[model samples]
Structures are given as structure tokens and as C-alpha cells.
Target: MTIPIALTIAGSDSSGGAGIQADLKSFAALGVYGASVITALTAQNTRGVTGIHQVPADFVTAQINAVFADLEVRAVKIGMVAELAVIDAIAAGLTRWLPKHIVLDPVMVATSGDRLLAAEAVEGLRTKLIPRASLITPNLPEAAALLNEPLAAGEAAIESQGRRLLAMGCPAVLIKGGHGQGAESIDYLVRDSGVIALAAPRIATRNTHGTGCSLSSAIAAGLAKGEDMETAVRYAKAWVSAAIAAADRLGVGHGHGPIHHFHRFY
Candidate 1:
């Protein structure tokens, strides 16, 4: 049987809660074949990131070339690029292959409050990678970092932030409202035409380690299965909400734990 393929270019989380591991799990959970190119290897757990070892930029390029050469990649999700060099390499590879759907999850900070991406790499992400994205999913801190401004104050400010991000050249931008104060989490998707608000009752759980990675990868999976942008976003939001709701069942680590990626199945 033919299967749709999705590629993730990111770091590796030793605890398997975020980065490449989370992205791959998300792809598989959504029924998309998953491939990966590791940009960095992180020594991290639910508590925090202890150390990080960046993969050589040339090796990162090689990995991307290998994947695109062999597989018919339908969608690509980018996350946790540690340095400017890695970002440059990824940008070059994406430019060459020109994947149909590119979902950029601007993962600057981890759930453990560890900074993942370097400050200098932010410019590379904005100028190079953002332009190539089919959609970008940025949390409040990430969005603020990208725009070099303070966090959006409320819903109206969030919508404005999304629009400003869209103006950066990405076709669409989703400013995740998880960090905002509300009974429900509301994500604003801003496109050139209009805005789409996706809301879900906030699931209270410390096991929310890989939420951003999973959400972006799930969106990529939906797009790979031929869903439209809005449809993909909605499906992804629902899936993540369910996963978050079921996360407490795992009872894994001492700190924040991972969501159940296969909650629908088992």
C-alpha cells in the first residue's frame, strides 16, 4: 500500500518527549510515514535540558539530501534548530527539494524553560525558513522573539501578531494561545485573506512536554493526507487536545511528561 511521507528536521530529545522523537511519533499517530534529520542531540528530560551537541551543518545537509533523494516527502516539519549554521543548511536543502507542505514550528524555548535555538539563529529563521513555510506555528514567546517585541497582551494582540508574522512572507501563521490567560486555548491562524480562530478547552496537565512539536507534525500529517490548511489545523488541534487530556495516564517522569500520541488507538 502507498503511504504518505513526512520529514522532520530537528533535534533529538533523549527523553523522547520533544524534538525529532515527538515529531516522528506525531506523524505515525496521524498515519503518515515519518523520516528525520537530527540537527542536534539534546540531553534532556521532563525536568530540563542539561546539555546539547549540535550535528555538523554539512552532516545535516547530507541527512536531508538522503531523505529527499529516497522518499517522496509530502510534508516537512521543522523544529529545534540550535544554531544559525544548521538553519542555513536546512534552508538550502528545502530550497532545493521544495517540499509541498512545510510546517515551521519556531521552537525557541522548551517546556522546561530551556532555550533551544540560539539568539542569532532567530534572524535566519525569520529571513530564510519563514519564507518557505506553508504554515508556521509559534507559541507566544517564540512569536515575540521572532518579531523582537513583547508578548501579545490578549486575543486582539494575538491576532495582530499573527498578521505581522504572515507579513514576514510565510503564507500562513498560527500564533498558539496556550500561553495566554483563558479558560480555553485559542490559536489564531492568520492568512492574507482573513483569520481563523481555533479554540479548545484547556487541558490541565503537567504532561505537556511536546505539545508544539506534536501539533505541527500533526498538521503536516493532515496536509500530507490532502487536507486543506484550515482542515489540517482543526484536525491537529483536536488530536493534540485529546492527547493532552490523556497524558496524565502515562505517569512517567517526575516533571512534565509527554502526551499520549497514540491515545486514539490504545
Candidate 2:
């Protein structure tokens, strides 16, 4: 049988750790075919994102259109869109040819503290993209930025934002707790029905590059395989934690690097 197809619309990371690269790695690990529409190009290594070039809106649109024309994509994971125009392009594409399953990661800043999306782009995301998502996976900082509301620390903050994100027109919200400085990485998933917390002890490692990209892409991969949203997110979290545990010691950057993508599945 042919592998299931999933599309990742994100920026390209030359480091091969985050963004489109990480998404591809995650999808492949989960036994899915991966496709991409690169929104921007980043010149960075494990050190950090040194330079970025945002693709024009027309170019982004063409890439998406070209892929959709040939691929029977089962799910979509959106990563970095650096400009308001890029967001508008994505919104237009989604409205015209809606993907069956859309997962928005709302990637704003990199773990290495490099700003990927423009500050102005966040507003466009709230207004245009959140409503179209099957789920929005945002770390605490991203959640706060999207809601334009300050949040208290820990699980309560994630839960609060998850609910508020639902109010913003998303069917579900996965407020990722990776950014919460704590012992356990607590991820909160909220739907119209209720909220579920997927908690695991955070693994201390320097190889955590592309983690957000991996988690969301894994969820998209799971959805492509016909899993439920809860099941998908839960499984994705477990995998990402494992990935962190097996992260290779790139030792190139001050920030966490990327986890090994070839570890044997437990």
C-alpha cells in the first residue's frame, strides 16, 4: 500500500533540525509520506537562526497550489509564516481549497530566541488562521501573544489559553507546556467537550531543536493514519519526549540542539 500523505507548510531550516526539516523527519518516523510548501528560508545551524528570507506571498501560494494539485494530503501542519502577507496567502488558500485536517503550530520564535514571524503577523493569525485549524499548538509565550492576554505560569495558564483559543474559533487547542520552566512538561489539549493534560517529566538535553515542529508534525502524521485528536496529540507527545531523550549531542549551539531522528522505536 502507498504511504499516507501529509503536508507541512513551514519555513526551511538549513540546520535540518526544525521547521520543514523537522516536520519531514517526524512524518517519516511515523510512517507517513511528507510534502512541504516552504514559507521562508533560514540560514542557521545549531547555533541559531542568523538570517531569514521570507518567500513572497505569490510564491507561497504557488507552492501550495502545486502540491495540492498532485497530492491527496490527509493532514496539514503549518509552521513559520514570517509576514502578514504570508498569513493572508495561507488564509486565502485554505478558504479556496480547505484541507481536511489542519494543525497550526503558530511558530513565532525559535527555541534559540530568534524571531521568525513578524510581530504584526500574530494579529493576522488570530483573525485568519486560528478558526480554520483543527487544532492550534502554541507554547506559553505564543499562546499569550495570540490571546493578547497575560497568563499565569504552569498548567493553569495553558488550560486557560486552550479554552480561550477555542473561543477564537479553533475546534481544539493544544497549549504546549514545553516552555513552562518546570520539572514536568505538561501539555494541555482543550476541545468543546473538555480538556486533557498530557504530562511527562521534561528530559534535560541540549538536543531539542525542532521539538515543536516534531510534536505538531507527529500529530499530523497520527491524524493522517486515522487516529483521533486526543490519541494523536498523546502519541505525539510521547514520541517527542522520547526524541528528546535520544537527542544527539550536536554541541554546536548554546541552546538545545536536535534529538536523534533515527533511534529505534521502543
Candidate 3:
């Protein structure tokens, strides 16, 4: 039987709520085979990240090479690149492989208010990685960091931020409104053609630790299965919403718990 494969290049969250672990789980939940290239490893839990150890950039490149040489990677979800070297390495690897669907989740901070990406690496991500991605999924803070402006407030400003990101060279941009104050969560998808707004009722829960990672990976899975950008994003948003709705039941961690990735299965 033929199986669809998706790749995640990110960090390792020991808590298993975010980063590579969450990405792999999302891929599996969506019925897509998952491959991973870990950029860094963190000693972390639900409470917070205590320490971090970055994998060598060359080693990251080797992992990418091995994956692309053997597996037919249908889509790639990139997250939590901590250093400039790692970003450069990932950019080089992507350029070499030229994967069909690239989902760049610009993971800058952890839910525990810990910064994941180095401040100096932001330029590398903006210049080297952003241009290569098919889509970039950035939350309010991340988007603001990229653009060097305050978080866009409300629908109109959010749409403008999305357009600004698109102007930065990424073919498409999804500006997530999860951080906004509202009864509903609104996400804007801006492309060269136009913008598509996605809204879902907000689910109040602390179990949203890995949400960004999960959503981006889910989108990659949808793309791997041959869905269009809009369709993939729509399905992914729905999947994440369901996961969030079911998250409170887990009760795994004391701080921000993880969403139920396999909520549909069990």
C-alpha cells in the first residue's frame, strides 16, 4: 500500500506538547506517515523550558539528506529553528531537495514565555527560510517580530499584516488570531491572488501548548494528501479546533497541557 509522507524539521520538546513530537503526532492523526529532523533538544515540561541543546547544523543537514534520499517527502513543516546556522542549514537542504509543499511555522516562543529562537537568527529566518516556504504560519507575536511592529489588532489590521508577510516573499501567509481577544478565533490566509479568512469558536482551555505546531503539521498533512492551500488550511483549522475542544480531558500537565491529537480515534 502506498502511504503519504510528511516531514517536520524542528526541536524536541521533552514534554511532548510541542515541536517535533507534536508535529509527528499531528501527521499520524491525519493519517500521514511522519519523518523528523530535530534541530535542538530541550529539557522541558509543562511548566517551562529549563535548558536547551542545539544539534549541530551539519548533523541537521545530514538528517535532512537521509530523509529526502530515501523517503518521498510530500510536505515539510519547519519549526523552532534556534540559531542562524540551523536556519541556514535547513534553507540549504530545502533548496537541494525542493520539496513540493513547505509549511514554515515560525516558532519564536514557547507557551511558558520562553524564547525559543535566538534574536540574531530572526534575520536568517526572514531572509533565507521565509522565501523558500509555500506557506508561513505565524502567530501575532511572531508576525510582529518578523515585521518589527506591534501586533495587528482586529480583522483589518490582521489582513494587512498577512499582506505584509506575503510581500516578504513567502507565496502564502497565515496570520493566526489565537492571541486576540474575542469569542471567536480568526485566521487570515493571504496569497498573491487574495485573502481567505478562517474563523472558529474559541475553546477555553489551558491544554493548548502545542497548538501552533499541530496546526502547521496538520496543514502539511493535508497538502501531502493533495489538497489545495485553502482546503488544507480549512481542514487543518477544523482538526485543531476539535483537538482543542477535547484537550481538557487529558489532564497530563500542571501548566499548559497538550491537546488531544488522536481525539477522533479514541
Candidate 4:
């Protein structure tokens, strides 16, 4: 049987709880073949990030080309792009290869309060990369950063920001409400058609290190398997919720452990 394939273009988390590792796990768990292009090497764990080494823009391009040269990369998920040059490289590669589904996760910060994206690169992300994406998954702060505004306060404000983000050139925006304060984590999937609110009960667990990466990759996996945007987002939300709920079962790290990406297995 031929399996659908998804690609992740992101950083490497030495801890194996986030970034490329998490993306691959999410793809496999969702029954998709996975490929990767590593953009950065991060010395990070559940607690925080201590060091980062960026891969040269040319090498990043090489990796991207190598993957697209052979693999049937149906969908792509991008995460933790830390430099302007790397962003440009990824954008150029995408233009050349043209993956059908692009899920851009504007991963700016780690769960343990470490900045992942550089301040100067944010502009590149806004102008060069965001437009090329099939969907952008940005949390509250990320959305605000993209808009050069304060964090949106309520659902109304959040939806408003999502709509404004759409004007930036992407066809759809998923303003994630995981950062919001509530018993329910509601994500707003705003398209030109309308807004879809996907809600899941917030599971109280510190093991949310790779939640965003996993969620975005899961969406990519679904899209690779031929599911539409809304269906993919809804399925990802439910799957992530279950993973978070089962997270406590795994005794991994000292803080902010990874969600059980294969929670359904054992």
C-alpha cells in the first residue's frame, strides 16, 4: 500500500520532545510517511533552550531540494525558522517545488519561555513566508507579533486579528487559543469563507512542550491524506487533546514534557 507523505521543515530539538522529532512522530502516528529538512540545531529540552546553531541557508536549500527530488511530499509543516536568510531559502525552495499543502506554524517561543525566532526574522516571516503558506497556525502572541499589535483579548478580538492576518496573503489562518485563559482551548480557523471555532477541553498538564509542532504536523498529515483544511484542523485538535490527556502516563523530563504522540498505541 502506498502511504501519503508529509514533510517537516524545522529545527532539531536535542531533547527529542519538539521540532523535527515531534513532527515526525505526529506524522507516523497519523499514518503518513515523514521527511525533514533541518534548519537549526537547538540544545533544548522540556525546561528551556540553552543554545542554538543555525544551518547555513545554502545547506537548508540543499536539504529541501534533496527531499523534494525523490519523496512524494504531499504536505509540509514549517516550524522554528530563526533567521531571515533561512526564511528566504525556505520560501525560494517552496516556490521551486510547490508542495500542495503548506502548514506554517509561526513558532516564536518555546513553552518554557525561550525565544525561538529572532526579532529581525519576524519581518521575513510576515512578508516572504506567510503568504506562500496554505495555512498559518499562530498562537495569540504570534498573531499579535505578526500584526504589530497587543495580544488579542477575547474571541471577538482574536477572530478580528485572524481576519486581518488573512489580508497578508495566506488563504487561511488558524489563530490558536491554546495560550488563552479558559477551561476550553478554542482555535479559530479563519478563511475567506468563514470562521470555524474548534474547541477542546484544556487538559491540565505541564507536558505540552511540542504541542504546537505536533498539532501543525498532524494537520499536515491529514492534508497529505487528502482531508480538507477544516476536517484536518478539527481532527488535529481532538488528537492533540487526547495526547495531552494521556501525557501524564509517560515519565519523560523534568518540566514541560512532550505530549504522547502515540497515545493510542500503548
Among these predicted structures, which one has the highest lDDT?
A: 4
TM-score of 1: 0.99
Q: Please give, for residues 1-266, the per-residue lDDT of candidate 1 as tens digits.
A: 78999999999999999899999999998899999999999999999999999999999999999999999999999999989999999999998999999999999999999998888888999999999999999999899989989998987888888889988899999999889877999999999999888999988889999999999999999999999999999999999999999999889799999999989898
In candidate 4, stretches whose alpha carbon ends up further than 4 angstroms from where it belongs are none
Instruction: Give the Å error, residue 83, model 4.
Output: 0.6
Clashes of each: 0, 5, 0, 0
A best-first ranking of the candidates according to their lDDT comes to 4, 3, 1, 2
Q: What is the lDDT of residue 99 in candidate 2?
A: 86
lDDT for each candidate structure? 0.93, 0.88, 0.95, 0.95
lDDT minimum window of 10 residues, candidate 1: 154-163
Clashing pairs in 4: none
Candidate 1 vs candidate 4, lDDT winner: 4
Query: Judged by lDDT against the true structure, how good is candidate 4?
Result: 0.95
Residues 167-237 of candidate 3 have per-residue lDDT tens digits of 78899999998998889998889898988889999898988999999999999999999999999999999
Would you give me the overall lDDT of model 1?
0.93
Could you estimate the TM-score for every candidate? 0.99, 0.95, 0.99, 0.99
